[model samples]
Target: MCGIIGVFGNDNAGRLAAVGLFAEQHRGQESCGMAVSDGLLIRLHKKMGLVKEVFHEEQLNALPGKIAIGHVRYPTKGSATEFNTQPHLVETLSGPCYALASNGDIVNYAQVRKMLENEKVYFKSDNDAELLVKYIAYRILHYKENIGDAIRNLMRDIKGAYSSVLCTPTELYMFRDPYSIRPMIWGKTPEGTVIVASESCALDTLGVQDRKEVPPAGIIKVSDSKIEVLDNDPNLYREGNCEKHCIFEQIYFSRPDSFHFGENVYAVREKIGAALALQDEGLNPDLVVPVPDSSNFIGLGYANQNGIPLSLGLIRNHYIGRTFIKPEQAVRDESVRQKFNVLPNFFNGKRIVLIDDSIVRGTTIRKIVRLIKDAGAAEIHLRIGSPQIKHSCYYGIDTPTTEELIANRRTLEEIREITGVDSLKHLPLTDLKTCVHCPENYCYACFDGNYPVGVPDVYN
Candidate 1:
């Protein structure tokens, strides 16, 4: 739901962090920020906007350091406010020093925050990133534990998905939760500058190759000379108590070029499209069109495998951000207006197969189908690349109620009628598992109600 990156051993660490944040802008759009550490001090800059809008050349130049961490914000946990923007700073009397940015929702946040409050810890914002920073500072400054021991304890205590990168005045540290519900990869540039980001695409933008994921429950410390593996503990993961890697990351959240959880994101999506195509071979469609950005490669795979000609029947406005992540339904519907347009000739008088990632609330897709129909398409066959989402997501995603999910409330036939499509087919749960690299480890809680870490009592 958010993007995080840290740059170490580079003089233009702030600029590199800015560039990395721009590459990861898709992961979050509500806000963006960067924290730079020059070993003596940490300079922080954050605001509410896209990456380019938030930071300018003058601001980036002012934040000079050898190390920096950046974040793009999507409101998975905190309210939409400038006060909640990250990387949340932890300051001593000296200056704003330790900086932390993390990518997942903490399920036990309320309990932890309450405990911290009872212990006289004052909180400035409702953001869980702030809690994480305070918790780490508490462990290091209060309990007198080293960074490695503090992080290990954090893994044991924090009971949810969090892949985090932190910048101390002295060192750069990155770690994943015991479950590894989000993605983190690190690579070193030819100049020996090490980079840790939420996705490989961030590194690719920086011209850094030879990337590798920080394994589940793994801690990585990047220094000038070498990268150290802090904690290799696998007690929870080996026993299968917390082995659920996020399936939605491959299905929707990640960029196609980025690799995560032992699979190429694009290849996995392509395989999913091919599998969906196989489910309806007898059906014929004159043209195959993807629902713009998210389903592009999936449509390519379907068109290539089924020998159906692919065309861009719908043109997406790159100026618009993702609508589904918007806070309200009215806002999302209004966003859909500017986000897509029908190409004149492609949708008229043709049997079109519309490929899309998934149908959540069915509001956006319904509007898109109306556009295609208005463009004079003779028939619309909507093929979704993922299984029906029958439940809601609690870990970092916005949907948290079953009532908000369309597939949970309506039958397939009813849904097809509602969308006004000639035919509708969602990729089956079984096929979806087979399409991924590690089928067994995926968390299909939203599709099948098989909550890996168990849904909170509040949702129930």
Candidate 2:
């Protein structure tokens, strides 16, 4: 739901972080910020806007240091406010100043916040990212725990998905939750710069090839000398760790070219499309058309398997962000037309198989169907790459209320009737499991209502 990156040991750390963040601008657009460490102080510059809007030559120069971390915010868990923007600078009295940038949401927010507050640990923001920074800082500053112990303890105590990067005045630290429900990868450049990001696309932006991922319940440290794990223990993260990485990230959140969790995101989506096509063997349509951008790869696989021509029937605006993940339905509706355009001539009189990632509230799809049908398409056979999302996700994605989820309350026929699609079929559970290959390593709460971790009271 958010994009975070850390650049260490680079002379142009601020600039590099900016480029990495720009690569992941799709991850978040509500707000952004960057923090750089100048050895004595953590110079901070963050605001309620896009990365490009918040940082420029002047802003980057103002915050200069050997270590820099950046964040793009979609705010799945937090409200839209400048106060909740990251990278959050944590000023600890007992230790050196550091900043925190995190992806994913914390499920045990209420308990953790109350515990920290009862200890008189003052907080500046109401967001979950701030809780993580304060928790680690509390351990290091008050308990005199080492950085490794702080991270290790955090993994043991925290109860939700978090793939995060932290930067001190002297070193950069990165870690993932025990479940590894979010994506975080580490790469290094020939120039001796170390980079950690929410996805490998950011590393591609930095031209780094020598890469490795931080394992579930894993931690990485980068200093002037070298980048290494804080603990050399061969058995901790290796022996028995339950790694239920969010499969949705591979299906939608990540860029198609990005490699995450040891698998190419685009490749997995293509396989999902192939599976969907195998299930939809008997149906015949004139051509396959994608909703644009995120679902393009899935449509390619579907079209390739079905022996139907694939066309860019819907031309997506490269300038706008994704509409489904945008916060409000009013904003989504107003932005939907601006985001996509149906090629009237191309789709004229064609029986089109329209492929999209998944349906959330059914608002976007209803509008899309109306657009294509109004443009002269005779029929729209809507094929979703994933199964119906019936449960709200607590681990970063913002579908928290069941009432807002169309599939949770409506039957398949009702959904089809509501969208006015001639026919609609979602990727079956069996087909989805086949494509993912490891159903056990995924939190399928949104599809099957099987929460890997206990749900928060808010969701209940």
Candidate 3:
């Protein structure tokens, strides 16, 4: 997944967009970019670096505008290169003009790209954001459609998850796919600056007073004169008449401080911990230790339910980005070595219950277990917050093939043996649903393979 933000009606739009993107740096660490519109020209700047590194004070000063759109990418659609960095801008003969940034993958990318190519629409990068912006530009140029009509037609043809922000020289627009598979929230700051982001935490960082989700198949337009909300009938685009938000957002992707999908992210994590605790009736470990950061709240619930002391035995280095989202397997393997460490004098001769969000490839957690084991821990019982991820994800996450997934290759007992944990148990799929508010409204395709939107033809 990725993070996207848009700022409208703010004189320092570039600076504000930078701040919002910084808050969402955890969502993507590969690269960051921003496009600013000064009502006359749209200027773009993007590079292969973190938000702070790319959008420094000097860089922000170079871009002056009252409307901005930004993105932090994790590389689902293309390789990690400057060429794939987003806020993809389309320039006409006039100058640099329309720009777009999005979070989520396009399943029908190949088919759509071929269709556009046949119509003589050239492409610069293989990224999904490029496909989206080029598609809209094609509609606007060829069909003589306005921005709203172009986006509506895009919704009818595009089949995947996309929570995107598009900006013209004079206005800003925000829209989500009909499935609403990713998070997109918008609000107005007390100072009257309009803001939209992939997470509420970014809106909170900007001191937004009132906030709401961009409805499923919804489009919101923000111009100097007015702010308009245009919502479409979601049933016309989705298989069912209900929403199918990605369940992993609540389980692991979202920040604990962020709220979306009508539930607090941390609360859902805590409930998953409680559910795991309920399954372990009599097993009492000396300490409940969580793989730092994401699993902290889950460990808290497990500790609270089991009356076991919650210990910060594992300390995570803030400098290292999340290993799971690292673009390459070699990068991910190297990150686990630098990301976490066992607290000194801790885990010695102690039986510990280790809480982790989920075991994807089984490489990171296996190495983590080895770290705790090497620290002289007597026993380590690993508890996962979510159910097994048996299928690949096409909506945003980078689990591309089932062969790469540990669950699809090994049984639970085999996995436990491979990880070297004394015992291991993943939260049951049925138990996981109990943690969310409207369980039916979420997608569990990664667990049960019940894809809300049909898989791409490539998979078939």
**Evaluated with TM-score, which candidate comes out highest?**
3
lDDT of 3: 0.93
Clashing pairs in 3: none
Point out where model 2 deviates above 4 Å: 232-240
The alpha-carbon deviation from the true structure for residue 69 of candidate 1, after best TM-score superposition, in angstroms, is 0.4
Error of 3 at 348 (Å): 0.7
lDDT, model 3, position 96: 36
Model 2: per-residue Cα lDDT at residue 38: 73
Maximum-lDDT candidate: 3
Question: TM-score for model 1?
Answer: 0.97
**In order, what lDDT does every prediction score?**
0.86, 0.86, 0.93
Writing each residue's lDDT as its tens digit, candidate 3 over 1-460 gives 8999999999999999999999999899999999999999899999998998898889999999999999999999898999899999998773336999999999898899999999999998999999999999998888888889989999999999999999999999999999899999999998899999999999999999799999999999999899998767888887878899999998888999999999999999899999999988899789999998999999999999989999999989999998876778998999999988998888899999999999999989999999999999999999999999999899999888888899999999999999999999999999999999999999999999988887876777
- In model 1, the clashing pairs are none
